[model samples]
Target chain A: MRNELDQQLASAASEAQAAAQTLDGSAVAPSRNEPDTAHPSASVSPQAPAEERPRHRCVELGRAVVITSGKGGVGKTTVTANLGTALADAGKRVVVVDADVGLRNLDVVMGLENRIRKHSLDVIEGHASLDEALVRDRVRKMLALLPAAQNRDKDEIAPEAMRALVAELQERFDFVLIDCPAGIEQGFRNAVAGAQEAIIVTTPEVSAVRDADRVAGLLSGAIAPKLILNRIRPQLVKRGSMLNVDDVLDILRLELIGVVPDDKDVIVATNRGAPVVDIAGSETGAAFRRIAARMLGEALPIPALSDRSPWFARMFASLPFGKRSSTRGS
Target chain B: MMDANVFVVTSGKGGVGKTTTTANIGAALAKLGKQVVLVDADIGLRNLDLVLGLEKRIVYDVVDVIEGRCQPRQALIKDKRIAGLYLLPAAQTKEKESVSESQMEHMTHALAGQFDAVLIDCPAGIEHGFRNAIAGASQAVVVTMPEVAAIRDADRILGMLGSRRARVLINRIRPEMVKSGDMLSVDDVREILGREILGIVPDDEEIIDATNRGQPVVLDGARRLGAVYSTIGRRLLGEDIPYVELPNDGLWLQLRKMMAGLR
Candidate 1:
């Protein structure tokens, strides 16, 4: 048993080295116009024309980004689907991996549920190749999904195995977004294993905020996590009845990437098995676009939702009669 | 003396008011003249003692009793305000793995012989701490709110507590939102969870104040949610009382009722 395990490790190491060498070989040939400088394989020149530079270096290879929330029903899957679609819509080759093994929902949300024949477990067990397991989106050419095995327990895929699977995907895709299962247990650990970054989805509720804080703490050391405050109610925030984006950011103390409003279109889009980003005129969809833009290092202004109350309502509340009427609003 | 009725208050998701429900229900039961003891099973994050206003008087906790550092009776702290209420606090420094299932069962059984009701406040998540919380309890109260995520977690918890006489307690419900079809209705929660309704707690700001002031809302007896908790306590003791109708049933509620009648 020990010898078999040792052989597997040795083969995996060599396979990684070979894959790295192949990537270097292709990247080095494009830079032949330049001098054979020190560390030719290490640094890909930035001056190499836009189309000629390695696509892997555009974002960084094997950059696994895990989207997780410690509490259930906080729209982690929704955020994953929308972000993946938005990123793909931006013309980046993206594959969203469902790491919630037994309770998979990312496929359904992405409208790729009908396309899945094999799954991540099949890829890990060597029963199927990564391309065979990956289900491409019907509408989006660049977006794909690696669905989780519906019947398999989360323990079937260890963190190390998940890391290897993600590494393989990273070689092919520009962005790998992992939809993590809700909890701080084996499933959470497995989802975060291969990811270089994390995006935590939370609502304005105290419970959701508290759970997000816990998840942020857990992912602090290994992964650079950013926050996405989902389902924000601007009216409630204006009335001081609910936690706003700033309040949530203060408590979680993570960099804010997105603030999606409580838009009804999100539910409609999900029921249709399409990402909210595909639905036109959705505020939530616009929010997701801003998030994707921010992920690409665009300095878009964070939309101010706190002052969304109507001018009439604001003016009335300041008046004595308006004060009496506004009390009923809360 | 009657054998104590042990109840475990649990919700698979965190921050769904499990500890708050445990503290209030235990206090309400004791207010009705039943000897009650609240057990905090969330070892590391102990909040039941603070909720019950008994944090400063704690000398030993459930861990000490299970590890034989103190007697079970020695660890039970008497409530300062309530006459028949007591608390078996969880250890703040100990991890959840420190207490085993069998040890929790043994301790709860010993306390069952002394108190009229034992309410164990289970931690969040369906993990080891959850197993320890429900070890010796004969029934479970699964608490949740009207959100989709909370209901899903409650459904998962109900599946885990199979054949354990579990009932649903819907917490922080907004009747106005329900009437306007903005939030989930009681029937919606019932259909999703598929469990018998234990009670419905309205979203009240006073509950937060009560917790911060180290007092149970049921002690006030005048607050809206306070009355609901007391009614639930009596219902648990075999009283058949209908749930209180929330106030402000305006035209929206009438329209909703008419729509329901048409359906």
Candidate 2:
């Protein structure tokens, strides 16, 4: 009975694989033609001179950014989900890829885990197509997720394969945000392989800062990464108990892209399997929106913790060392 | 004679007190009359010598011994304060790739034959450096803080340790925070990592001062942290000592209990 069951399961898997391959073969071929009519830039390709091909291709490709932290649970996935949702809310097509492999959480955090039909490993292993692997977000039409295989190890998908997948995704989406696994290992290298830019996420702690410094040094040769300081408690900073934004900047020496204050709402939203940006009246959601705007090259005033404090506290905040200027653009 | 045990002190995330733990535990073990040798496996960032207050006496390092430039005995620095405590310093100028796994394994085995315990200070991250550090050890001690990030990395490291005689050393735990549910409790960490508890070291500012002064906390004798490390040493020696309990954070603890009761 066991042998018969195993045989049936194997045959069913093979049948599904064959069906997926057929679907993928058609899906991959027609996407290019489908985009030609939808995108005006593609129409310019036939009319453009041969000399402008390289420049046109560069304009057509989207930016690929990897969010990473050498320390785990410093909110790399949370930042990726919020940033992707915020970008999608701004009407930009976005795809967030979970590159953490065995410890996949981006899909759950994005509230699209149950909808996963195909995973990144399936696409890389030729069992599924990119379209089959990409799960469109239920609430947000502009956002999609390329979920990682939960059961697969980090070595299942090589860096070269991830690069190819990211390159293909870059041609279709406006922003490709890859959520990197913690630690500078095979998974981290794979996450950063195809990305043009990097965002280092860290919390206001000595351990996180040191790991971020190490990660920054490793990523220095490949991409000049921007730093996102997450989980900052203003009250603790004021008490001089925690490392402030400037202290972190002094250690990391990277462009400060965003500062996300610690809020209970973030944990609540994460527990509910929704990005904090989807929660109404979330301060962290507003922070993520500001980060997205800053990424788009918008010059907005940095939100101040003192603005939410009492009037008496604002007077003490005016001290030179207490106040921080808005992070200037790179 | 019983076989000498080897333990590798590692935490996947940096700055979680791996080197400090190694130094203090070595000193504590030596204080307990066990011959101990602490190996610094963080080649590029040599900190074990500095933590042991033997930085200036380092004429030879682990790489020098591994490359046959000097005898392992010559590279080992004896601590004058703690009898039978020695440190095999790492080469600051050399990268992690300078030392191979086989060389480290052979060196550790040779040292284990002479000492009662060999503690290898593994570098942060699960890279080549980490692999080289753990290759020699028969046991592993994963140091982590009470924060979610450190616990997550500890879980990953524990997963990598995989069937090795590994114990979780919860370091820098702020009891007040844990009591108030602001920080992860020992129960929470135990549940997540599912490892046997070695000990919990309280978050103490004196540890930083002790590190800066090149004095291991175990040498202080008077500090609570010194007692904590000594207790950890006793536990490693197969003694059953209960963890140190901190004073409650008063009304916050009551409020949290009431909140739990409501739930």
Candidate 3:
């Protein structure tokens, strides 16, 4: 079983490497245990690495800090959902503030949408107070969710008011994650108004990283945006097709936080309205859990995406077929 | 915003259903009694003919017509199913650079009056081949998938289209993927691209088999995506074609599933 697992892990690594090669333009030697490297692009080369490990996940243990990416579908909600679950699992009171005004997806992702009656929109519009919108995740004892209203667009909310609401949430929770909408317009500006520290979620593709780079450029004079590369495909990197996780980090040039592999189970669980972390033994779910552990001042290293499900890509890596033509990987 | 005779099918990235889009849409237009021409512009990797499965019948390609080797009549490969629709095949042996800017200009100009709409299959890059494809085209149809890389490239392409005064076309979206937030739907791509979305083609297998056999899938009517392309072609002709936006989550999808009982 252990040998089978090892081969499976290697399989997953090569697939990730191929995906990475498409974007990163280099071959990543798979670390024996998937390297626990946050971003494959941040891995620098086979030799130089990104940061040694994640900085402390909990700043004061009691004060809540929500890190969000302003762009939608670039992995903001994933970061919020994962980080909130991670913090709560780590014994911190984490509340994810889904500030996506009209699009209430956080509760749907966290599997709490069915229970949401009064969301953050009603509270902000004076229909209800902030406390009334907080919906506790039935699975995570210490974690809570503040749903957004489904009826209004982003223009209805104010940044200062959203910030004030976040401040109040901070007094009660250890961490508050605000999932932002896509675009650098009103929605993004509003989501960032209150956070003490910001964590930007980006994929390895040039566009997502480019947007993250723009966000990082905006963040340079202010608080540094911590980087989290979600939905990185390692196999594509090996084959020189998709951008590597490290290439993204290099462009944005932000401190690397966590790397999440592209897992089919993520969709499977999310469609069932479950955050992946609840699956327990799934590779991506474990990665999210490790991310939570590291956030709580735990010493666990951020695992490289190559380690999870090594069985997926072993055959492709060993193929001597691609070494000759395609002048791409040099 | 173009006159009825010119429709250009484009995608920001290569291989995201642009050629397939051209085949289906042109076939759709041809079926509607309008004189249509599908021009292959990807100079080196010319597969539009192969994808259309009209490779064998070609006597002279676009190079022959532009380089003055043969008259446009001898080079035009007429499809049997659609009486008015014709295809101008590109040269497989030559690179994108083989055709000069003026040659591409004169080619589309010459064809403008001959057909009601000239559908140019634009090549897949930010280079010369792309320029040649758009040289004579009046309207643009930007085809794209709902994935991140496709969306990103589509945005850059949209910026280019906006500068050139062209409309956009979206293609090959999976409704289930959108509902689960795994992939963006037509709405997401349209919002991000910020261009008028011409049509949305659902991920369907018949289109693949059609591409395999080189026949236009629009004639098949077995798949809804092909029918959607036909409707898109009508919309390109300014016929006010109506297609309900396939929602990220909806009841038709549920009913479609109950009937097919897809796994």
Best by TM-score: 1
Query: Residue B66's C-alpha lDDT in candidate 2?
Result: 91
Write the residue-wise lDDT of candidate 3 on A1-330 in tens digits.
212212222223334345335322455333222223454443212233324322322222234344554233455666678778765554445678876664456776777867887977687778876556677677665577888776556667888888778876765555777776544445566778887777778765433443465566655675777787887667765644455554454345677777888776775565566778777577777777666655544466665533222211232233222222221222
Query: What fnat does each of the candidate structures reach?
Result: 0.04, 0.05, 0.01
Candidate 3 regions with alpha-carbon error over 4 angstroms: A1-67, A304-330, B1-263
- In the order shown, the candidates' Cα RMSDs to the true structure are 10.7, 10.9, 16.5
Q: Alpha-carbon error at A112 in model 3, in Å?
A: 1.8
Residue pairs in candidate 2 whose N, alpha carbon or C atoms collide under 3 angstroms = none
Q: For candidate 2, what is the lDDT?
A: 0.74
Could you give candidate 1's per-residue lDDT for residues B1-263 as a string of tens digits? 21238889998766678878998989889888989999998776576876776776889999999999999889999887888999999886677789899889888888898888999999766656778998898888999987665676688778877568888888877666666565677788888888888887876666755764467888875665676788778777667776644444563354335324322
Residues B61-178, model 2: lDDT tens digits: 9999999999999999999998999999888667777778888889898988999999999976666778899987878899987655466567778888755788989887665665
Q: What lDDT tens digits, residue by residue, belong to model 2 across residues A163-245?
A: 99999888767689999986666788899999999999998665456567777877898899998999887876665556567
Error of 1 at A179 (Å): 3.2
Ranking by DockQ: 2, 1, 3
